[model samples]
Target: MDNIAGFIFLCGLVLVSATQPQDEILNNFQQVTKLSHLGLEFADFFQNVTLSDISLADSRAPNEEDLLCLRDLTLFSNALKERKLWALKMIDAWGSIPSGILTGNRHNLGNYDECLNINKDISQGVTIRGKYCFLQTSLSAMLGSDIGALGVVTRIKTATCFPASCSAAHMNLFVSQVLQKVLNLDIPSTAMGISDASCQTSASEPWDGLTIFTVVLLSLMGAIVAVFTVYDYFFCKNHNELPAIVKAFSARANSRALFRIVENTSNPNVISCLNGIRCMSLFWVVFSHEYTGRFFAANLNLFNVLPWSKLPFASFILHGFFSVDSFFFLGGLLLALIALRTMDRTKGKLNVPLMYLHRLIRIVPILAVAILVYTKLMTVVANGPLLQGFSGETACETGWYWTLLFVNNYTNVKCLGHTWYLSVDMQLFIISPVLLIALYKWGKKAAAGIFVLIVLLSGCLFATMMVNNYSMMFFQNSFSIDAMSNMYFATHTHATPWLIGFLFGYFLHLNKGKKFQLSWISVWSGWILCLAMIFTSIFALYPSTQSNTPPLTTLEESFYYTLTRVGWPLALCWVVFACMQGYGGMANSFLSSPLWQPLSRLSYSIYMWHLFIQEMNAKSSRTNSYFSDYQLMLQFWSDIGITLVVAYLLYLIIEAPIGGLDNFLRPQKKPAGVQKTSSYPIQIVSDQKVHGDGPSKLKETETIAQTISE
Candidate 1:
């Protein structure tokens, strides 16, 4: 017993010597250990627990639930010792403090250079702020705990280290993941400031190798496309004329043609209100995107705006998800309308390949140009933490296939990320022809049967989500992205909007220009019902704004999400249906006015270019981010203005060419008995299907060769 006691005393002396004479660090280490065992041995460890530097009299203690969390099982305790020992070793090797550590602010992780088999060649550092986040947030849980915690996380995100081959961001991810696996503890090595974390940096050339190759290839292709297009547009008009580049883009030369193009595209025979609705919807989408930009980064004050996100019904800003459904509805409506018109013109013949080809050609050229701009040109002009090696831009270096094939959403490797919508829309369009053909061939009963099946399937999917208690607030939570990207963004989960829109389209086709006799009560009732649905769908979350309100159950949230999607689009269908039948009154006039003509005309281009602008803006400047209506509004308008100018330029260069080619070069065949089917002159349309590989909407198109006489 004396020998054992002697050995235990020696162990204590060794531990005391190893920890140095710093009671502060050891005290903090003990606090972490106490926290780990708090739930299991609360009474025994309570006296030992200390919150490091945190002692808030104004702040309440963490609730029993938070205090009793499944902790890291001394995740930080050993971490503190390992780091202290590593520092001592580094000091011994250098005979002084390590480089760039300044002895603090950013903790150095160079000693762990190869800790996770990462082959890391960067000097990594971890920010000290997030270590206090859980404590700070736990104290403020009832009165907006989201603020400081979120900002700490985001601010911490900005501390990046430059590296060769693998980026600091990648290195950090590797270390955190590998260490967690090795240690059997769910802890971030990056957050711990040990392995792969960096306060040190080195410049990496993004324009090296593959970046250079892709850029040169794109430039050569651009020149060729430009030369061919110039010859086609100008030389075709005057067979022996030398093409002028200036003349190609001059507003004076193309103003009449541009107006003529606009006139040709505009469906004047239909109520102008549809154009108004489309323009408004697209503008709202852009607006919402701008406001939500802070959510993308951890350095921003995201939780400051959590109230807005949590507002439930009144969070029109966060409710951009539903606006996307509006596009699916619009896409289905237009696709059905166009398909029915074509089938009627073709005498029951459906050309699947032609339909697919038309949609593809209309979108691909401009989309390819945009992708090249991001992968090639954008790289030349832009390099920031978010752009150089950290952002989604890097993905485009090799992710073009999943992008072009429109399977990026499903593949989880999006090139543009925004183009997933086009892929989905294309897929839907391809499938849509089959369904429409069946309806066209077999009449109302077939359409009804398909519609019923779609409704049932959508209900089943929603029910599944409910049974599983899947979250509806994809943007509101940090962990929601995986589920959002996989399930919410995919075509399968979101097919409801398209199906609903198709029903509206078929109904409209069947009742084309037919007069309906309606009593005052019915018309009023229809308007009231439509307005009620629109408002309810958008505003139902309002009850959630009150902190006092009860939290929604899994069943309630599931129903709300499912119903919100169906309801928003259904209301829109009614608005269009009523407007078409001349019941919309001033609302119709406002929606269909020529004022919306210019905005709607450029909507597709705006959707394509806005995100790139946002990406550049996000990484180029670093500032303390704050959240407020003023700040969001400032960003919203500024983004719209810049996005508009860029959209016009992209349209002039990339988008306009496709329309110009079809309009000027394609042979106009006036079929003996029927007019040409309406062609949608679009390069890209709506962020509903394509934005973030999540959602974007659509616009109507008319084939360029057929001038609108409507």
Candidate 2:
């Protein structure tokens, strides 16, 4: 025991000593080296000086003799300690320091042979201040060179012992153009800060090797993912088999799991109001897409003011299409409610395969038809040849593959434009069933924790953006768009926002179970708060004060970019709360209208096909194609009109067929009585078909299975 204690003490002592101050080590070593240099003339001079006499300024006359003596003393002192030697070298390489400051003396003789002659002169012995001033200027220049050394120089007019004088920009260009070709890091030119001027004009030269590798790698990965996605979308689906878990929850003792919510029609006005909001949210999405390219432009005239054009409130109004956020929030809430109803009806298994299938059937048909027309028909009409424009930029078009495959965001770059949002929405929906299943199993606490984690992930993403010099990471079309596109796909950053929306929906659902007394005071206060958040989100999302940079004004940007990105979605839950509070009025009347029904029914289809129509219309000569490079943009509105008709037709044909097929497969039987509360124990069975991995062990699997059996 004593020996072990001794060993531990020795280890602790050694660890402490290792971390001791560097100055103590230097001081101890100097004693031995300084003793040997006592006899040397230069060393004698340095040794004679008391510790208090050390200073930057020269104490001697302005001749070369004094300068030589100073140099000799410096060399002798440097030789006494390794740390001193390094420090002296750093001073010299970084440009000189004041001798007076080091030695604690007040010599003012500034005319030294080695130092550059500036206008300042010190006839008296060199002062510490003068020496410090010279050191400051020299150090600044040295730092500039140090930074420069990191780059390459086309021409070397002079050379120095310190390499910082070399051009850093040139060195970076050489590394990118030459070294990277051999290394294959796939480092983007944007990441390296490479300029266009230094690179060669030829297409081959501009690409370097990294770009080509990136394109090939991404294409390969995308193809692999597509294979899995297509399989999951098609063959693995069993709308008829609706999971045992879902069946357990949806059914009463008499019925089954996975049931749909039948909105309370007790108050027609309230239902109407909620429906109206749904339609408005859909319109907001469409308008948001249309306005995105217009209002953000600094040069455009808006409301006759372009503060960027001296237009004040006009820009603000245009920016009000901030409604895209509302759409997102509304969509999440509705989906969550549906999931809740489904979970409650079914025992615990929601049919994920059927969910994906429903989405695929609804989105694909229109997209496929659109892709064919744009790629085949449009190409032949414009290029005067079929399949001629099927490669490169000419191949850019709205398509079914992205929506059908739940990869809308992934293919946004390939689509004409303004398609990323639609893609992101659909992608969110594709994964919703899986999320709902988790929510059903784990409950609210786990969902909230996941949401918080997602928000933190978004924070880290924002931090990355700040570190990378505010390079756009969202789907904005700009010089930084390429960088944005690359980083946006990082699941850690992008997918978190959707999770945030989901949690808000879940939270609202949890709250709805509790009843609160509705007083005049509370109702009015709720109204005020709802209006405030709406306006706050409006100002927050679209600050028209400035335009060259930052999506919002300084104040609004903080709230919009930092707060509202998450807050606005949560704020949207209050709309439902408000409608529920009061059953009748203007809000209810507006919502109950026939206008709301068609839009709500077609919202998903509209979101899917809107961009395709826009792109096609932009290609039309009648829309004044020459007036806008975005020929597909004017066509977007017209396409929306055409697509609505087409999508409605598809809903009747394509979507209805699959929905009907699922209904037929799982035909409703006679209503049964409620089962015992303990009968349906929640059991989660991993979809091996989806996970395509090993089995998960669970306690009481058989009992849980029997409980959920149809």
Candidate 3:
């Protein structure tokens, strides 16, 4: 009897595997069942099933065996089965299981459009259309792969076509029943699931409340911009009788301000090198983000990133975080220069409240607009499997208020996580008046005290890292949330660079007009040292990125972190000092070029919009990008081009207008007398006069400093 049953089972399997003239559904059912060893009962169940037997509208509860066969046939069809094998094959050769399995196959996105466009006729009035669904599964968990030891969940893509009427909820139920009851295969809930967000019968999604709100808000803003633009062109040009609000919001006035660049022939005090630094730093930020965004999105050769990072030249990309430190240094430097100058002009009377208010005005409006666009409009912009996961709209929804308050870094909520720098900057700005006031009152004595304080703070930072075991290098395998929170994002940990810049600013102010004639050897030595410090800070961790290198000890990490934090800024300070003192030569010429002025002016807007553009590009992509230097360079240029155009519009529409409005609203003081001619030659360029005395004369200076600081 046993021999007879075995023979019958083999014959049944052969019969099912035989080529048949049938519809795609029947064909898929045969192909899927051929791989299963479900004995005579399962084979019998599928053999009897026909196109007419499978009704999407049939509400009656299916038999356990029948439902299992149907679900398997629908999900593991010929196309999807091929994709699964492709995914495994792509990653099989990779040495690092974490890198390979974590990202899965970038090319595993099965023909989504083809599936969605399927409109097959089952019978005369009964049509069975295809619904393309994205099913995410953990290959590591399913195959019991050792990648689970890395404590990361593996999300591999599997896509398939089902009947249009079979919704995600129904599919989920079918999968669960088949796994638990029919197959008796135990799987974790997190290991496999259907993505309802990715299931699609068509491209268009029904408009929701957030979409409507975003559209209306954008439309209203556009109407306002149009009205003000027309008013500025038709009426305000000829008449000065209109309200201040009209002039402030004028697109014409704002665009003019954005494009206008004045070279200060007389301002020996102006740090012209800052323009180049700001522009280049922003470019670095954008470039790094472009590469990282691809890593987060689907990259077919993601495992290659680890090997590429080991290269010496790769430090430029890997160490891009130093660019952010450069901004912090600039912020502190500009704050000291402007505040001290303002104090000198006002004779020791500095308006602390106004300083805070001005900082808020410079940051808040455009930031609010960015947050709104991210939270409300991103969903309306694109659709893809990656979009929902990577867009960060959900984080924005809950944490936007924290971002507005400039304290999101401490909290788990991060609307735009990159804006953590803004929070740190703001906090530093808030407390700076105490130091500024002291420096103004006591002069050199206060400077000595502040230097001592910086030293103590540096010691504390070193101690904190040592105690917490924070790694010096970011985004390495050993990097953790604890390290990021304690060292990377902490305000106190960053104070060393800011304070270093502050001292440099004060030194520059004190020696503004004094011509330092250094010997040729001294100048060359300074340049070499400056270049060495900067390069070391950027590339010191290259060995750590190499495959065979051991991880740095806690003491080594702390020492490197402390040294680099201070040394990097000190190197930058030398560049600025050299440029200002006329020893910069070709370096100064490049740094102080007029070409950098426009980009420097637009840097704030670029910083705000660059990440959004990068994210949008990454998330909206239907196909996985090939990871290579050539591809990255191409994407970088594309991202930067889009960023510049958007940043220009944002600057004209928001940043410039708000700045003008701020100037208009502030109570203007009449000129006291001819501005006291100090040894330092300061140039002021605006619609207002440069030589005008009192607070009014400081407007142009204030605006210039604000641009640098932002």
Candidate 4:
């Protein structure tokens, strides 16, 4: 009995695999047949109707063959109509036939028109004689065998029922004829199919795609890699390595932390704009990295033809996050203006220590918390390796120390590779002030000329890199090169575009008296051009395709590398100029919203922390089966959420407190221009009379400086 049961089970598997259901095929046939009939009927209906009849000139002529085809299609309609009726009638007598009988083969019943007629007559023999027709019988007889599927018919009489017509209907008739020749039209006669019956004795089985052992091994390997990656991201191997991070987040918050910058002003515009740009840019960075990383890992060639194959731009319309040079340029400009203003107002004697102290106060607390949280999650929670798999690449991984120290400018550290723009900006922080001091003394024209030269130099350098096909360096190098030679992009390479922003700011400040011409045409045109530049960058740049090497087409290569980096920046600069000129209307309403403020506030922390979160999520996905399909999207959003939470938390706990500590560490000192005044209210007189001086000559300068700083 057991042997018999096993044999039956094997037989059942074979029967199931050998055939597909008849209902699905029948439904498809009916659908296609109906559509063909509908097309034919519409043609006939329009034959007698003219455009003039409906007050519109009908340009297309109705095809006669279309009418004939519709008439012939009625045969299948009639057959289907009969089948439905027969099934209803046969319901009472069901199961009289063998239980295992197959029904799929009976589809051939529609093959002959005469056969159908005969069957109809047989079924209705002495009951009644009724005319069976659909559409028009006369029209049906005109098209011989061209109405429906030809293979469906078994005899000449059936074929004669529908013939092809030679008119506007030729297209439909041609399609109908081809379909008829392709379909199966036979009914099953056997109690069981030969293949299904054979399964009882000789069962069949499908080959397995993978063995159990192999699956287990793969799972194990995945777990190990995930574990290692989680460990690396969270734990600093040594205290000395991350002291600033520890101190900032520690219960006893300290003054010395990472990312310090000083400025002595409460200017809302400077602060708000910088913060907003940072947050928005970081979001863009995360999106680009997450999407692009997945795309490359999957080895998709969706945009193989396009050169600018990467994130944001290649993925969709809003993907221009990959084109994040806009933020860097903005920061550079703001920094330059602030620096220049300080110099001019202070009679060329800017307090460097005060500036550094202020910056340190703002930056360190947030930096510390970010490092701590990221380190904890990566090390303790995830157990991932530091730098993940980047341990092997000496050139690339060597920059991690520099990154932590925020000395990436000197060491070229790029722990968060995509975040190199931050490092570049930090380096700019040191250099821009000095440059601003020079601009105040040397004049705006000279400064602008120097900026132009730098831009040209950047362009030339990009040209050289592309010419040599430095694919590895282009993609891999994070932060060692001078701002001019940063390989990843044309904009953030060193401080090249930053310099442009600085110069623009300087010039804008120097020529402060000129009224901005907010002519509607120029404003709208500038806005339109900014939009066009963004779109062009997307279409022309962001997609990446697998190539043994980068393409060598000079025209294609030069165009993308230069235009996306160079042209887009200039276009953006123009946009900024326009906005400054008017600073109102739709553009202002959009940019100055309450929503933008928070994003700007958290932008820096988000930038610092997002990548570590993304790495964690990516590892988590491998372990969790639920995210198998939507891993990429999940990881992207997860990174964003984590970054926000972490940033806000750090902002409150570390950033806010660090400000106080920073102030304590470096107490506010006297301004360079301040001098000791006479202590007595009754000052000894000049020429034997009490003489009093008005407000210090430095009042206006101090006011302006204070305003600019704020």
What are the candidates' C-alpha RMSDs? Answer: 13.8, 25.2, 10.0, 25.5
Which candidate has the highest TM-score of all?
3
For model 3, where is the 10-residue window of minimal lDDT? Answer: 689-698
Regions more than 4 Å wrong, model 3: 1-107, 115-131, 143-153, 163-165, 176-186, 197-211, 235-246, 264-266, 474-476, 672-710
lDDT of 4 at 344: 57
Instruction: Provide the lDDT at 77 for model 3.
Output: 40
Which residue segments of model 2 deviate by more than 4 Å?
1-264, 267-274, 291-321, 379-404, 416-438, 471-479, 482-497, 508-514, 541-559, 583-585, 592-594, 622-643, 650-653, 669-710
1-710: candidate 4 lDDT, tens digit per residue: 12112212222322342364777545533433333222233333333343333211123554554443444334324433455443222221111111111211111111122212222232422211111111111111222323332122111100111221212233223323322332321212121111111011011133234333334533453454344334434665644554443433432222122222322132222322233333344455566666544432311221231343433434442334334456545655655555455555457776666665566456544544444344333433442111223211343334545545555534443444443444445555666556766777778666877667667867775676566554321332221344323454332353455566667777667655465756788777877878887676655433333345454454565556555666556765775555445543565445434455445434455555666666665533311112122555676776787768865555445443444345344335456665311111001100010000000000001121332233
Candidates' lDDT values, in order? 0.53, 0.39, 0.64, 0.40
Q: For model 1, what is the error of residue 586's alpha carbon versus the real structure, in angstroms, after optimal superposition?
A: 2.3
Of the two candidates 1 and 2, the one with more favorable TM-score, higher being better, is 1
- C-alpha positional error of residue 16 in candidate 3 after TM-score superposition, expressed in Å: 34
Q: Is candidate 1 or candidate 3 better by lDDT?
A: 3
Candidate 2's TM-score reads: 0.48
- Residue 429's lDDT within candidate 1 is 72
Over the full model, what C-alpha lDDT does candidate 4 score relative to the true structure?
A: 0.40
TM per candidate: 0.67, 0.48, 0.80, 0.49
| Candidate order by decreasing TM-score | 3, 1, 4, 2
Q: Please tell me which predicted candidate would have the highest lDDT against the true structure.
A: 3
lDDT of 2 by residue, 1-710 (tens): 12212212222232233476878645533432332210122223434454334422325333553343344334434443343432233223211111211111111112222121111212354311111111101111222333232122111011001111112342233334332333344334333332222211101124435445544643453454345434534644564554432222121210111112234353311223445664565555554454443332211122222232224333333444345455555445545644564466576666665555444443454455444444444432332101123332343443545543545455544443334444556666766767777787788767876777776866776666555544331223222654445444433444543575567657655664455568777777766777786677555334334555554323333334546556555555555566655523465556555445445545544554554444443322211112122532453456668878755544443333333334333435535674322221111110000000000000011122122222
Q: After superposition, how far is residue 19 of candidate 2 from its true place, in Å?
A: 62
Give Cα distance to truth, residue 134, candidate 4, Å: 67
